[model samples]
Target: MKTIGRRMRFYRTIGAKLKGGEMAAILNISQGSYSDLEHDHAKPSSDTLIRYCTETDINIFWLLTGEGKMARPIGEVEKEKEENSEISIIWQNGMVVGNHQVDNDHKYLISLINTIQAAVNCGLGKEVILNYIAQLLSYTEVHFKREEEIQRSIKFNSLDEHKESHKRLLDQLISLRNEVGSAEPGEHQKAILEILFNDLTEWLFRHMLDEDLKMTEYFNLEKNHRVEDNSEE
Candidate 1:
């Protein structure tokens, strides 16, 4: 097994109890990638690592160095759990965009943000946060293409405008990433996180509720018509 994957197996078998495909789903990665990750052939993206650590409460120290316990100390773990739980966006079913794939993708994206927040709350470090942001932006581009495909399938009226919006948001994130990448790592990165986080909260969370939900309505109506016609036949 690869180093991280071997450590992940230890982390899993030692303390955590999760199903096989759960990590892959949470990371929005292919099952093959997860499998390869275990064998040490494939490396995890920043988003995946952050998601894994956040969900399992695995010690970043243990994950990297493999010289410590997989889980945090009980006292610190409890305190951190309480702290992290206090400031999370509680995901709910109402956010569903009526399309299974789109809804699931949205769920994963929101979870990524939360994972970063949890890592930060646990005081992981600016390095982890910076890496997660870069990974998050890359994954967002992949998701945008999926969303655009759905838009084309449904003939979404605002497809052109929506594509533009996606491009603009992506450009903003790329700009932020470049800005942060050039800066020295330290206290200043927190300000960058704040700006990026706020933008993400607006774009990912708020956009889901405001814009994606409306798109859901349109898509659902189209689906219902198809269903009704099928039933008649």
Candidate 2:
């Protein structure tokens, strides 16, 4: 049933309980494209197919190859229910790392990550979780850029090392974002979600408490030295 018409119709029917706009939003596509998909006027993108499988109970393996059960089994449901352990708890004020602007950005990033965690912990819909992930990734790119700018301005001695670390986290975020947008659903998908979420949350803590603190300390020292030099003059 991989024929364009059959595949489109099958997926459309599966999601028929929801509005075309709603499904389109979940897949990050336009409503017109979703209608075209349902009518077989256009093909579903890999991301759309993946979102369908993720939001519905459809076994993506079967949807792709048509060789397995169409519906996921109860084991997945059990795993979903049990897998919500705190991925670094709620953000607290202790996370602040000095500079007001930088601290504000970190707070926003923390809120975004916390939203992602809430999605997993509260058994939120797959679409909701993915949306939060997208928000986190977008904001992270902005935050990292700003952080790097601050580092450059300060001429922080550790800037190179800090930038390298930022690159690694950016790579991880891009990889996870691509996987979430296109990977077929199953145990492996669930595992990817958990591992990536943990990776991101932990990175936030590490960067804020360690790397960011270093930047703060450097600026503080420079400011104090300038004060002492001015007083001596």
Candidate 3:
């Protein structure tokens, strides 16, 4: 992949299961710097990458090239499992936006991303990735519509702004999907898949935390305002 940090974070979180602080300590960097690295805000040094792989038994080649399996197996059993395993995001409690329907949609979207990632991990080729991306694009359109409806029902002041954000994300996805459709097989397709998955993961995760979580804030404010009105009455 072009961004080493994304692969670093994937190995750190999925393979090693290390938290940011824990991973930073291993890499001998500040937690803030490590966070920046994972988010692709900062570039990691070669020393840092080497140290991380050395400590975790991660395959440096795979981490750097996005080829082969992730972990360099220390045992036969581990080797078998690692061989079959794919890089995927684990859903966390903190990702929940406190809106049931929206949260469900978010979970499903994450699952879809994970499925596409697995297909890529197994070297399933272009057609499979294209089909999965098509399905994801269809569901995402539905999810955005549902989210906007909820916002409207609640009289959310920023509904229009939220709709605009959805439009932008969808447009970006469509662009990437089209690129995948036209890409040649083998290395070219592999490169596009890497970019597509990394970009999609980053955008969707940020949307949930930075944008979708605003819905929870709106709900809390509304509840407190109603409480104040009752007290005044």
Candidate 4:
């Protein structure tokens, strides 16, 4: 119960910093219940677990196992002991769609994103930083391609718009990388990192809720259809 309480408190502390009311809304839980969860007065249900992971970028490993840091392990504490510098991305479960391939791809993309953040936080040199960015860009393209193919196969109506959004994100990332590449080290690098963190955090959250959620709904419908057909047969 204390483990649950610690996890909930961890969530609540970050949630308060990031806007408690908004996070509660995203989790679809009452603020009172959310507070209770943080205080160890209540436990999260299955659905709450799914939503928290998806919405808050909380580490499921740390949440469940209590083996690692409560927040993302971006850098060693001795290196940049800044009180506020912690990686705050949560991994949400993709809720077993019939498409194993697509789900796996999504997980890989998430891992890449987290890895890049970790690399940045570790204070790597410019070349190493650039390499990480390139890796992120490359994998993101592949991930988007696979996701689009799945949408096309199912004739998802918003495929065009979704793909367009993906293109825009890719373009933005490329431009940002180029900007960072030319900047002198030190303050400029820090500024570039701030921009990267803000943009990436915003984009991931919105994309999951807006674009990826649509795909999740489509797969759910397809799954239900197949189940109904099998029942009929």
Candidate 5:
């Protein structure tokens, strides 16, 4: 369908076989908001679009433009990852938030996620994979603190909302970590990896692209004003 609403409803009812509430939970939105999305009453944010794509393994380009296949084939996903072994989640220019330290932290976080993917693909032991998850979670806490500090320095208006988002991400990571730790190695390996790739990685991706990118506009304006002041001196 061309309209995102129609497509959303189609995916919810047919593609993913999920009810509205279930899909809403997956996107971290309320039932009312999800209904509005399906009825074309409201446009989705970048965060919503990213969550729908990543969580459902739906083709993002198709989700927005309806140009590509609805979902990438499993073989294609595996092949693509094999070809790009260094990174599982591709970083794009849009993900940059115009802050050097924060951007570097994002890059490191992506690398940590990729490291976990590699471990899973290599059939590493559960303990080894758990260690990587711990590293990602630890570094994520550091990254969130750094991000909040930078925003505070600038008095970013959306700081509170952003911090709440960080808390949600951390909670999801903790839950995933516990779930993976509890699963049987051979039986639940696939399920564990799927959650890592879809839920955890994409949630972080959505945060950087949608939440942190908000900083770019404010940061640039702040920089420009500072430059003008320097010129006046």
Candidate 6:
């Protein structure tokens, strides 16, 4: 764990250098505290660690074990592997309403999914993995709030059903975290990673396809009505 801490500090330094003060601000920590991380004098909280990875392209595996490249090197091999990999959320025009704001939020969700994929591939230790999950939970809360607001504005008849789906997702994610927390640290990493790759992926993919698609269609229909009414006027 001490070694992992050192490696984390190393990567944080490199990441801070790349992103400058914006990353530090997002984590809500001082430059001095971040400096302490780089210097190996201060251990970061799980929330802070998660925010660092969320804000930067640092390799989670390298940050833990100090074995792999700090970033996945760009190459034909990497590109081919990424292409072949099954993404958690399958993007479809039919699943997106073409509302710029909603679409942008969806894109951010995809980014978070991809980050989780990267973290899993990195084989980081339990603590680091948990930290990443915490960060995901925080961001998901904000995203859900925005999504529900949009649904309300449109008066989508299925808003209650959609909100229930979001609640279910939150419950499942929290349950997974609790289960991981109960396990011995060394044994927990693999189990949590498996859940992310299998259960979480399936949930996100199904939720978007089955539930979000309805919202998309509803918004599109409303948009078309306004356009038609304007033409008639």
- Candidate 1 lDDT at 188 equals 77
State, as a TM-score between 0 and 1, how close model 3 is to the true structure.
0.61
What does the lDDT come to for candidate 6? 0.59
Candidate 4: misplaced stretches above 4 Å?
1-84, 94-99
Q: What is the C-alpha lDDT profile of model 6 across 29-51, one tens digit per residue?
A: 57765664445424443334544
Cα lDDT tens digits, model 2, 75-194, are: 564464356355334444444566778988887887887677667667665677778888887888888889889888888888889888888887877776777667567776677666
Once model 6 is optimally superposed onto the true structure by TM-score, how far is the C-alpha of residue 19 displaced, in angstroms? 52
Count clashing pairs, candidate 5: 0
My TM-score estimates for the predictions, one after another, are 0.57, 0.54, 0.61, 0.60, 0.68, 0.57
lDDT of 1 by residue, 37-149 (tens): 45643344333444454434454345445557655444575575456443555455545678888888887887787776676666666677778877788789888899999
Reference-based lDDT, residue 179, model 4? 79
* Candidate 1 CA-lDDT value: 0.62
Candidate 5 similarity to native, TM-score: 0.68
Lowest-lDDT window of 10 residues in candidate 2?
A: 1-10
- 1-233: candidate 5 lDDT, tens digit per residue: 11222223333323224455765775566888677445642444443444454434445554445576765454565566556544466555545678899999988997888788888878788899899999999999999999999999999999999999999989989998998888886767667765565556556755675478779988899889999999999
Which of the predicted structures, 1 or 3, would earn the higher lDDT when compared with the native? Answer: 3
CA lDDT, every prediction?
0.62, 0.63, 0.69, 0.61, 0.69, 0.59
> What digit string (tens of lDDT, one per residue) describes model 3 on residues 1-233?
21222333443333234455665765456777666446642444333444454333454445445577655434543554356445576666656677789999998998998899888878787888889999999999999999999999888888998898898889988988899999887788778877776677766754675468779887777779889999999
Q: Which pairs clash in the backbone of model 5?
A: none
Candidate 4, 23: how far from true, in Å? 12
Better of 4 and 5 by TM-score: 5
Deviation from truth (RMSD, Å), model 5:
8.3
lDDT of 4 by residue, 79-126 (tens): 332553445454544223347786676566556666667767877677
The deviation in Å at residue 217 for candidate 6 is 2.5
